[model samples]
Target: MSSNALDQFLNENLEDLRSKGLYNEIDVVESANGPVIKIGGKELINLSSNNYLGLATDELLKEVAINAINEWGVGAGAVRTINGTLDIHTQLEKTLAKFKGTEAAIAYQSGFNCNMAAISAVMDKNDAILSDELNHASIIDGCRLSKAKIIRVNHSDMDDLRKKAKEAKESGLYNKIMVITDGVFSMDGDIANLPGIIEIAEEFDLITYVDDAHGSGVTGKGAGTVKHFGLADKVDFQIGTLSKAIGVVGGYVAGKKNLIDWLKVRSRPFLFSTAVTPADAVAATKAIEILMSSTELNDRLWENGNYLKNGLKQLGFNIGESETPITPCIIGEEKTTQLFSKRLYEEGVYAKSIVFPTVPQGTGRVRNMPTAAHTKEMLDQAISIYEKVGKEMGLI
Candidate 1:
């Protein structure tokens, strides 16, 4: 029998969430997660994927993955420290380092795991971390895992960061101080002020870490935000994921040779977890190579993003201040936002609603991710559906 107290706790919290309309019921996709997807036997113009460059279903990547599987079989067999460090894994790391213009790079099982492993490996109870208010959940968990003194700086507010850095440094109560932030804020699509942050980091002599997961393929002409700002060599740790724009699975940290070397021996995930499969490593490598070779897909992605934003803005939707392709159509109430998403699904669009805990309360939004694979026709149809639903729901 199940533990009664555990069961009761889950039941009460779940029912509370349901009653408050905050419970998110996930819809399973019946087809490939591409520009279009099928769910429940119905087709949808998918605007909810992180496949920003549309390489997830690229022909060349699929071919490379197949070849890799043929050569390396399925799994890596053991944890990286226990002889699971395959040649393909090494190749991928080298390619990532080159792509990010870093001296070396270390790959992890997943982006979330990368954060969990990398942060705790270097920081501990004696250190302090100054984090942006809206950093990703993984970053938050990673900081907490480090058992460091976490100081929250206001989102994109360099002034707050500077003040906190000053305090953290002047106190001299900590052995080390680190400033970490997302290169691109996923929710609002705003870019971080890396120049200002770097200046402050230099002033305070603090370590700098930038998680550019959403910015890798979508920013800097596909190089990333660090390269975009010409600060590639300045940031101590450059974290990214192969799962998003790269069109595969895994995460990585690109930095100086010494840093990567330290993470390889110290990061818990790298030491204890088996490496990504041969296919995943090769596919991710191929994706990065493609991005490095050409910016065609990146251009297409920006075009689509601008096009979608214009259409929604013309339709009188409250599209937030997103400097990147990740657009959020702000719809005030939580239940209303969910209803709007449901209406969108019914009308053949698969954009999802994001509410509190994911975002702040009463600032619910239908987040739209426009990828490179999307055609103008699909976007126009989605916009038309938005118009119909917005009119009927009196949202526009």
Candidate 2:
């Protein structure tokens, strides 16, 4: 009587997930997600957030957000195409272009939406996208929405990318070809070889896009991976997030003035969705300003990252070969990965396990994100707990 078909479908899917041990129970955070987090009244050392520079809890950002709320109120009231494009929004875009060393920029409600808007804005069924096998989910979705012919390139393999680029160009099956990659892959924390990618793009005349979500505040002295390699002008579409590292909520695309203008007119999300709150725009602007003004927070983040990576490696856990601070303590089976993370949680650490299909099967790992905010004392306690748990589970 009460939607029996929908109920059956949901019940079957839920049952299948549980039976396969793929179901996850979301935890409730009882406090701020800082270097440490409180959940179920237990304070645990937090290594899971993407808040790299600890800007989310910084006093300066908070004060600026509060001031913006007082001055501009909360909501943007409408989409950017209508009446939502405020002065602060324009300021944020200008500041972001400066940060990325680009001619202009445009903002979206969130990073995921930025992808959805930017990709579909320019690409269509006649176009093609050469994507990294390890690119983020948002990029994958964006490529799909574009209706472009998607060709997966091997991870960080310049030769493979080049071969595919040549093949795609010669196939004569597409109008425009865009090669997309994540500036810093989130799971392993390895940065994309932007220089290698740019060389190929130049040779093949491919539009280059880099999603610098993880790399923006964490790499290139807080500018990003594209700038890290000095290819800011060479790259085509530079996508970033206001949430991660910037410590607020929003997304943006920075590029040539013409491209941004096209996006402003054509990107569906920017056209349809309401703009971000004034507080978000101003707070993100302030955070970017802090990053541009100094590298103190960036230094701290790298130092903390190195400390965590060294501690885990010395303890004999197989933290994979990572170029950045992201550490993954591999524990093969899915159930073991989940159990290891649960023990870490109970032991005062709160790293989470990533399993298939987020990653390949039998390569399940408990990933760690050491931030600038984590003190030496907190890191030491976490490492000691890792040692205790590793021995208990015979993982070391």
CA lDDT of each prediction against the hidden true structure: 0.96, 0.93
Q: What are the models' TM-scores? A: 0.99, 0.99
The residue-by-residue lDDT of candidate 1 on 1-396, one tens digit each, is 999999999999999998887999999999989999999999999999999999999999999999999999989999998889999999999999999999999999999999999999999999999999999999999999999999999998988999999999999899999999999999989999999999999999999999999999999999999999999989999999999999899999999999999998999999988899999999999999999999999999999999999999999999989999999999989999999999999999999999999999999999999999999999999999999999999999
Model 2 CA deviation exceeding 4 Å by range: none
Model 1: ten consecutive residues of lowest lDDT? 74-83
The C-alpha local distance difference test score for the whole of candidate 2 amounts to 0.93
lDDT by residue (tens digit), candidate 2, 136-212 = 99999999999999999999999999999999999998899999999999888889999999999999899999999
Cα misplacement distance, residue 394 of candidate 1 (Å): 0.9
The numbered model that scores best in lDDT is 1
- Single out the weakest 10-residue window by summed lDDT for candidate 2: 16-25
lDDT of 1 at 42: 98
Best by TM-score: 1
